[model samples]
Target chain A: MIRSIFIKETQLLLKDKGTYFWLFVLPILFIVMFSSIFGNAGTTTYTIRYFDADGTKESRQFMDTLAQIKGFELAADNEKSLADQIQAVRDGKQTSLLVIPQGYSQRLLGKGAAEVELHRDAAEDAAAAPVAAVLDSVTKQYQEHKLRVALKGTGQSQTGIDALLTAPIQVKDIKENVAKANPVTQIVPGYTVMFVFFIMITMIHNFLRDRDSGMVSRLKGTPLKAHQYLIGMWLPNMMVVLVQSTVLLTFGFIVYGLHLGDLFAVAAVIISLSICATGIGLMLSVLVNSVNTGVAIVQIIAMGGAIVGGLWFPYELLPKAVQWIGLFTPQYWAQRGMQDVMIRGAHLDGVWMTILILLAFGLAGLAVATASFNRFAAKAKN
Target chain B: MKHVLEVADVVKRYGSKTALDQVDVHVKEGSCFGLLGPNGAGKSTLMKLMTGILQADSGMIRAFGMDTRHQMSEIRQRVGYVPQEITLYEKLSAVQNLKFFGEMYGVNGAELKQRIAHVLEQVGLSDRANEAVETYSGGMKRRINLAAALLHQPQLIILDEPTVGIDPQSRNHIFEMIRGLKKEGLTLVYSTHYMEEVEALCDDIAIIDHGSVIAQGSLHEILEQHADQAVYVESDYITEPPQLSSIKRASARGRGWVLESEQPLHTLRDLSQLFAEAGARVHALELVKPSLDRVFLKLTGTALRD
Candidate 1:
């Protein structure tokens, strides 16, 4: 009996064009659009326009130092005037502009200090702050060089002067336990988990359709038990969710070269997530009184869970309080589990806790849904 | 005859409203029992209770001698129910719908296939068995709904207003099919607000109103006990109406006169002589027997449809 119901449900869904659009087409569209926008996972670089007005050796050396900084790209030409460059910055074209004033080298040599003017748009603060800090470091190095030369000329040994110029303490950064935060890796799983939740709408709609059409009461009149009926209705939708997750994951791997660690663990997380979605769909079908209300409630859950669960952005970047709320949504755990496997390259051993939590959510949802369904059926009899 | 179904003092309540109030009914084996009532008169509720789709709050319902509450699964296996609404999967074909419902009753293999084919043929939809129910006409869908109920070949079939919203041809087709089932010795519980349908198809009936049974017995007995006997007369060239105390009531009816009375024979004899004396020519005169519709109206003080 369960198998029969499952087959019937699957066939019904297959005949519905809307289900095809949501299950296959919409997820692919979302994945393609979001991946293209956030596909680059490497280090980001900023371009700076520089005018070398100081035609001296010290200014040339300072320009060379700026070129060697790790994430700074310099323009090929100094042809644009200072006014033009500053206008470009204000117009949002140029991120930052640097001008080495004439006689800068002479001033540094004579008074040990020379200021180079830096122009930037305040609105581009995210890009402008990094450029300003790098320029400051470069000028300070030039001032140190001038002092070292002056001290060497005063009859200190060259090696001793070089040693004295170097600071007693040096700080070097060694990255530990950090993986590259690839936006593609984060987005594919995040949106996949979020969109899988939308499948609940279709599930609930089918269940309610059966109820409104009187099929449920007819089935109830049969020899089939309630538990068997519920299982029959639920299993097919859960399978659809699982298939949808597989399709999205495969699309991620083929197009974006996403690396998923431990294929078994990935499957486990996805299956658990599908179970949770199915349970939620069942619960909604029994709880809501009408189709319109069911659709409204499902939209709220899907969109709200997507936003709060960090499908649109990284959860780590959200406020501490919001992060606490994210933990309450199923998307958080499912997305985190995917991230653990795909981004962190952790195996099943690392994601077991998240998988367990997802299963618990599924079980709780199923329990509540079953109880609500029993009550709804009883009420329907009355 | 053995009783196939018995409802004793069954009471069902929904929150503040009582849907079924102390209802009692007994359906004999291999007999067509008509549940007659107006809309919301608890006919559907009573049928659902017998099918074990619902539980009574304060009574006992037994189907095939098994308790409906505890042995519902067993009871359901022997009872096929056709709900008032079209309960079929409209997206699926006739064969698919029948096959699905057939399997739910644990019918499978060659037996299930044969039964599906037989029911489709029985409902006169064999030629269109592969078409989706949504594409079929309303009458055709109603027929298929009946066909689905007949798939398992249960001993007792419960039909709740099965002919509603169907064409006359299809309604007659359903009536014929139901009569054929009765001849085959399958007990049936037919619920409807149509008095003609009950008169045509049912052997025994129970008229319910306000959640209780107002009348129940053999169809002939109920009609005899409650319905009035009257003689209808059609005449022309009458200047004054006839005056006879034996005539309980006399009124013009469509270019004719109808005289109703308990003693219809004496009333008819007196009306003929009176029309002769009044110099009126009798075009037609006949005695009309009591009908179930009149019986229902007399007992409920309202029309069957009202």
Candidate 2:
């Protein structure tokens, strides 16, 4: 009997063309849409300015080389005023200014070191880091070349020894990647929550339809108890939700390289969430008399849940009071589970609290649904 | 042997509005009992109650001797219900809808397939089984809907307004199916607002109105009380409407006017005199008796429509 019902429900879902499209096609479409929107464009531009005071071939060569790196746009001191030129570079892109002091070559030749001034726009200090790294690399290479020439002037076959001094006396250092937040990545969790929200809304209406069409009453009319009927309707939708979520997660991995850790825990959280959503749907069915009414109710709830649970924006960014309100949303719990699994690399044991919260939601929803269905018998005849 | 259904003093109310007021009804083994009533007469409500789809505010109901309230599933297993509205999956084929409902009823394996085929044939829907219900005509869908209920080979069939809106062909097909089921000894509780259906098929009828059973008896017996008030006259047909003062009721039927009068001979003589005085042609005329239609009209002042 259970198998027959399962088959029947499966066939029913299959026969519904609209559901098939929404369940399978929609998430893939969203993935493609967001991926295109957040295409791999590399990091932000980091501007570096060259203040060449020493007119030697070595310094000019060094200056010319450092400015050639990607995300590095330099200002030559000969064509424009040094401070003004540096200011222009900063204003044009990111103001990361580098100065080559006078007698810098003589100081290097005498086995002495002089400071090269690096000026930066305070607002763009982070953007200057990568550009500084580029300057450091090029300057280090120039210093070694200068050292090799100096050793050649001294004669006495010091070329081999000069080559051996790989570490230059002045090696400018650079190591930073100025990364910017992409709207697409930021909205992934929101989009996922939106998908789950839309699905739950759809399932909720189907649940109520059983009541409106007298399907539930008819099922109850049979030997099946209320709980069984509830389970039958709910399990089919829950299974669909699970399949849809899995497909979305797969897309996340393949498309954006979303590292969803702990497969078992992720699947468990999803299944638990689907169960909870099913319970919510059942409760809706119990409260509403018609499919449209149930849909309207779910729509309102889904919108509220989506907004509060960070489907549109992260709860962390919201005001403290709003965040408190967001915590009440089931979407919040679901999003929390997903973010934890993805961002924190947490195991199932770690997300157990989220799973429990979602389970509590499901249980509460189921309780309400049962209460409402218990009254179905009374109103059915009319 | 146990009776298929017994509804005893079931009282149902919609808020303070009484929908089924202490209504007692029964369908026995292999009997086609008609539940006849006018609109707002609670025929559908009574059917819902009988099928265990609705619970009574008070009183008791039993289907196959099991309490309907607690043992609805057992009762549902024994009976098939075709609701007043064509509550079907319109996107699916007739056979598909049947399969869905059949599965719900736990019919599986070759037995389910055989049952589907048998019912399709029984309802004269074999030719249209694969067609989507939306593509079907009004009558065809109703036939398929009935076929769905019959797929499980239920012991008791409850058809509420099964023929309400259908073509003559479909209506005739449904009546024939009911008759065929009767021959096979399947008990049925047929509810409709149409009195003629009760006259044609029911062994007995319980006429309801205002949430109560106003009358209940065999069709012949129910018609017997109002028999004297009706008189049917068959004529080669008068050229115009015939005036008979003693006619407490009259309706223009085919090839004649059925006149219900207290004095049939006098009315007949008066008809002849009037035709002679007007120089109207009258080939023949005879007084006939009352049908269930007249009996129903007499009992219910308003016609059976909102």
lDDT of each: 0.85, 0.74
Docking verdict class for candidate 1: medium
What does candidate 2's lDDT look like per residue over A274-346, in tens digits?
Answer: 8777778767766776667776777787778888787667678887887889888888888888777776667
| Interface RMSD of the candidates, in order | 0.7, 2.5
Fraction of the real A/B interface contacts present in each candidate? Answer: 0.89, 0.43
Work out candidate 1's RMSD over C-alphas: 3.2
* Chain B TM-score, one value per candidate, order as shown: 0.95, 0.83
Distance from true location, Cα of A105 in model 2, Å: 16
Q: Chain A only: give the TM-score of model 2.
A: 0.64
Query: Can you write out model 1's per-residue Cα lDDT over B90-109, one digit (the tens) per residue?
Result: 89999999999999999998
TM-score of candidate 2 relative to the true fold: 0.76
